[model samples]
Target: MPLPELSISDWQDAMAREKWTSADLVEGFLAQIAALDSAGPCLRSVIEINPDAMQIAEALDQERQAGAVRGPLHGIPVIIKDSIDTADRMLTTAGSLALVGNHASQDATCVRRLREAGAVILAKSNMSEWGYMRSTRPCSGWSSRGGQTRNPHVLDRSPLGSSSGSAAATAANLCVASVGAEVDGSIVRPASANGIVGMKPTVGLISRYGIIGVAEPQDTAGPMARCVEDIATMMNALVGADPKDPTTSRCNARPMVNYRKMLRPDALAGARLGVARECFSGHEGTKGVIETAIRALRDLGADIVDPVQASELPFFGPMELELFQYGVRANINRYLSTHPGAQVRDFDELIEFNNRHAADVMPYFGQEFFELAREKGHWDDERCLHIQSELRRLARDDGIDKALEKHRLDAIIAPTEGSPAFAIDTVVGDHILPFGCSTPPAVAGYPHISVPAGFVNDLPVGLSFFGAADEDAKLIGYAFAFEQAVQARRAPRFLATKS
Candidate 1:
């Protein structure tokens, strides 16, 4: 069998058994992309396919034949969000038309690691324009260049933003796995909606070099896959230090551990899990599913701490917005000036370009956020620094850290998102619901993982496991145990819409 119905281990076993080569696996996925992504469902998940994917895969197959396997991800096909730089033929536009001609001179640090592990960079997945930092009321997955990426589970529903394509493609089996970035709900929300596993590792666990940034404080790229085991395997490949990103220095200080070895089916036993009840407010169906998930955890020997005030601190949204505005103005300008292949050089020029081509770029919504970024003051302004420091303190020391310490918990659990994928509405923008758990871990720069918990009327809801900084391995173990117990994930049928 090809990779369409196989996990990473299964595919490796198949290849070892000589059932198929890496080249054959790539061809199977390319066929699936053509059949489902471009024609059948027209999910628009992949923005662009790497033309040299087959050649890369064939070379990896040759390596395997010569007894030169690199790692667990050897010959595995992977897709990365368009925001990541590949230093290849594909454009890194972050789903915006303004940077349509831009290309990277070198791979993102994470991409380099994946390549070193012998993974094929199969495609660049579509994302929210500028990772949803373009407009105030922008549609989640709508991009001028790649168009809107619809939910694989339900075609008319939203796939969430930024990491939308990564999750959607993974759920639809377009690739073995995909990498997605998250400043907030981008990774997990889409994964929840698409019924896959998405992980947002502690910021600095993976290098951010060559990725288009929103805010350095919250931005991090992570693995999204059909199983938590695959995510752990990818984590082993992705975690590393890079001099280009100073935040990554923290990772170098810590001793490395094999994440895949951390996965245990009985990891949940004797673990104390706290539930942030705040996230249980929205969507009665989702709440019911989370309740069932909690029961399952209990049955599996976990001590559940009901109603933990982990996210009691507020004002993070506004504070983060201020930081994003400052960071975007600084980060994008720095990126454009340094990247020789960039079409637009600065935020002002990008705005001018968008205005000039509004019919194409802003047909659905205006670039208010872009305009806001351009108008922000210098990055080192006292007010900006104050907000930045206060945000970290509140979100870290007073928020997640406090909760973990007070309850003596291994990790906090909650619904990954407020509800299932909302309607894909460009005219009215995204119907963002309330009571999400992404912000706490996002702002804390802590590790968070979303595992498919259960379904709500056929729409998938995820159980989020998040905790203190550098607790990624523990959270993954917990998530893996929960995943094995619940077995909530299933391949999407590409239903036209909800009746």
Candidate 2:
């Protein structure tokens, strides 16, 4: 009953038979992680293995035997991005040395939901340093606490980030699924690079109570896994209202727990889909793959409109960065104030810590963004106050919302990232300019999901489907259908090992 290539639903169905149990799956995956992380390919995707993963899995199996099935996620083993708080044995460091010994005092709201749904938190995955804001020079997967997490497909290339290990671990089948949080390109970019499904749920859709700090306006935890079905299944557990953060409560219009049921094979059949011009302008290989994806949508009977133009405002670029910097200092400061045991107290203290431990903390890169952000005033400042409202208004109302209303479209399609992961460069920062698929949805705080479309020169590529706010299900449904129709996903071969 065990399928070595089992997905979330596939594994659940197989486990329904008495012959299959969570322990079997856990054992199989633990072996997989050991082989990949230690011996076979030597990936550092798993930052820390949960010592009690098997114990938790065995307990869940017993609960099921006692007629207490939790739901789709019951007994499913999933790794959490280092940024997500587990409130368990694993330290939630977000791949930073400063927080190495810190354990979350409480489970992040999203983590609690997964546990409530009976999913076993398997491990803590590696990530970009301080979720990629600390310094540009550090490699995407080379965190101070956990070294580089190589791409499962090709060891030398990137698996993308700041959710680097989440994408690699999920794509490599080290876990049944994993959760990845995004601030702009973190989830979608890595998903594209690793050939998995990366969903950036609408801002406030999932509670960020225990998640490590980032720019809240553009930050959200979503599913990063092998297929669209898995992403939807994980999302069902992750999305909800939380009292700790009023934003989740304010997202009254957010989708409730049934994302998987919304997947219709014909979801794209009559939908109006736009071809994002910006997403394809630069990279030839990526553009070709996206064009092919668009053609597939057209074959599915979608009306594909190319260059359905939307607003690109005067203050758009600077405003997004501005919001992120202001939000980072404010939110990280707030998180520190609440969680006092962490080594660093404020952004300034974090800077001091990095200076004190520069060899380990800033070995490869300096915190240019952090220094710049520290100079910016708090969210309450006049410039910060004026810009935050304007940024959200412009990104949401004048951007994605405007495009959808003007085109009368249900969704838009774009290359999830410009291309696949570039070679890891410790001295130089990320070369991520080609992302047409990320910006609007990321900036707007709307939902966007990327599914594996194909590969270019053996590296992964992705196609993104995004829509206006409260349309998480629509994007998921369309991406699922497209994935089904194409079946383009393939596990990374790393390299054909032949002497």
lDDT of 1 by residue, 200-256 (tens): 999998999999888888899999999999999999999999999999999879999
TM-score of each: 0.98, 0.95
TM-score of 1: 0.98
List per-candidate RMSD values in Å.
1.2, 2.3
Which candidate has the top score in lDDT?
Answer: 1
Q: Each candidate: what lDDT? A: 0.89, 0.82
Candidate 2 stretches with Cα past 4 Å from truth are: 1-3, 136-138, 250-257, 310-316, 496-499
Candidate 2 residue-wise lDDT, 1-499, digit = tens: 2237678888888888776799888888888888887667888899998989999999999999999899999999899999888888888888888887778889989999999999999998999978877753457888889888888877778777789899999888889999888888789888988889999998888988888757777788888889888888988888888988877985565435588887788888898997767666477888888889999999988998888754353312677777767887887788778677789988899889989998987777888878888988878889877876777777678777888888898988888777676776677866666445687788778888999988778888899898887789888889988999999899777662211
Worst 10 residues of 2 by lDDT: 308-317
Q: State residue 98's C-alpha deviation in candidate 1, in Å.
A: 1.1
